[model samples]
Target: MHLSHPTPLQNIMESKTCSRRGILLPFNSYSSHKKDAQHCIFCDTTFPLRNFKGKAVCPTCSQNILKLFLEREVR
Candidate 1:
C-alpha cells in the first residue's frame, strides 16, 4: 500500500459531537462572539441570552422588582 502526504487546508473548522443528540457541529478554536452570553443591565452580570429575549434586565432583577411593586400595591 502507498500513502500520499496531506494537503494544506486553510480556515477549516474542527468538528464537535453533541453529547445529547449525537450531532456533528463545527467548532472553532477561538470564539469571536458567543451567542449564549448576555449582559444583564440591572445586575451587571453575564447570563444566558435565552432567559431574556429583547430585554436588558436579567430574571432575578426583574422578579425582585416585580415583587417590590406588588407589595406596594397591596399596602
Candidate 2:
C-alpha cells in the first residue's frame, strides 16, 4: 500500500519497559506469561519487578542513566 509517511514500529504500540509510551520495543518484549520478571528499558536484561518496584530497568542501565544524570548535573 502507498502512503505519505510510515510510522516506526516502536512508536506504534505501548512500550513494555516504560510506564506509558506508544512504543513497541521488540527486543525488550517477552512472550512468557511470567509476571514476576521483566526486561530492562535500554537493554534486554531480565530483572525482577518486585525488587525494582515494577520498574523494568536493569542495574547496568540504571548506572548508565545515573552517570548521565550526574554528568548533566555537573555541566
Candidate 3:
C-alpha cells in the first residue's frame, strides 16, 4: 500500500506546536459594542456586563465553574 504525500498547508499545520485556542470574538460583534464592563468573580476579567446575562460572572468563567462542578459530581 502506497501513502499519499501531505500538502504544503497540511505539513505546516502539523509542524506547528501551538494553535489558537479559547473563545474567539468578532470585531463587529455585540460584545465589542458594549461600553460598560464588569469584573468576573472567578477569572476577574473585565468583560461586558451583558456577557454575564444578568449573572455575576462572565459566560466563560461560568461555564468553566459549571464544568468543574459537574466533573466533581461525576467523580
Candidate 3: the clashing residue pairs are none
Clash count, one per candidate: 0, 0, 0
lDDT of 2 by residue, 4-70 (tens): 6656765555344458647665664455656755677556777632234456777776758777568
Position 49, candidate 2: lDDT: 24
lDDT tens readout by residue for model 3, 1-75: 654998888888886856856887657765675575557766677654324455567667676877856877998
Model 1: residues with Cα > 4 Å off, grouped in runs: 1-21, 27-30, 34-37, 49-53, 67-75
User: Using TM-score as the measure, which candidate wins?
Assistant: 1
- Name the Cα RMSD for model 1: 11.9
Which TM-score value belongs to model 2?
0.31
> What TM-score, computed on C-alpha atoms, does each candidate reach?
0.36, 0.31, 0.29
lDDT of 1: 0.58
Query: Which 10 consecutive positions of candidate 2 have the poorest summed lDDT?
Result: 47-56
Give the per-residue lDDT of model 1 (tens digit) for 23-64: 689876445456645577556776532354566666677668
Clashes of 1: 0
Off by over 4 Å in 3: 1-37, 50-55, 68-75
Q: Would you give me the overall lDDT of model 2?
A: 0.62
